[model samples]
Target: MAHFLSESELSKIESEKGKESVKRAVKSKTADVDNEMRDIREQRARLVEERKKKRPQTTDKRTIAEIHKEKREVQDEIRRIQDSISCDAKIVLPEHEST
Candidate 1:
């Protein structure tokens, strides 16, 4: 098969393909991170609820300090992931095309 593509054209096409792959990879990673954050939030909410349901007259499932500590850890984890991953689709275009 004969192909008609200049070297520069081929380079551009290859770069475009690479960008597409990068976008997909970033999207997948972002989703995974977002899901992890959501799970952490849900876990923290459950902990808060469980801690609040203790009756003064009965044995509690967990002490207040323990619940607070776990909640804080979860919050920290969420912040860590949020800083490392962008939930938004941050597609990075080639510099020449960015303008």
Candidate 2:
């Protein structure tokens, strides 16, 4: 037999579903950001070590190019994280109708 729910009940169910979806999305996004931040921090630490080995070397164009490449990679990572969070927020899980 088919049953009907009142408007308030329907709305409440929808609100709950939406809240849960948002919570999951936020958690996923937070995890991704934390992982990426850790990776970037590790890379920066390595860069620092490279800088500290003050083996007075000539200014090489390749070093300059590598630095720029690293900078761009970091920027891209940040942008990807932001996009992931935003995309996650836009997702709406299909609501299951109550029996």
Q: What would the C-alpha RMSD of candidate 2 be, to one decimal place? A: 37.9
Candidate 2 — which pairs collide?
none
lDDT of each: 0.70, 0.74
Q: Which stretches of candidate 1 lie over 4 Å from their true place?
A: 1-17, 55-99
Best-fitting candidate, scored by TM-score: 1
Model 2's TM-score against the true structure:
0.37
The superposed Cα distance between candidate 2 and the true structure at residue 98, in angstroms, equals 99
Best-matching candidate per lDDT = 2
> What would the per-residue lDDT of candidate 2 be over residues 1-99, giving only the tens digit for each residue?
223445775566558778677566556656777787888899999999988896576778999999999999999999999998877656643245323
- Stretches off by above 4 angstroms in model 2 are 1-17, 57-99
lDDT of 1: 0.70
**Model 1: per-residue Cα lDDT over 1-99, one tens digit each:** 123445685566557778676566556656777787888899999999888887356545678678889999999999988865654324454456655
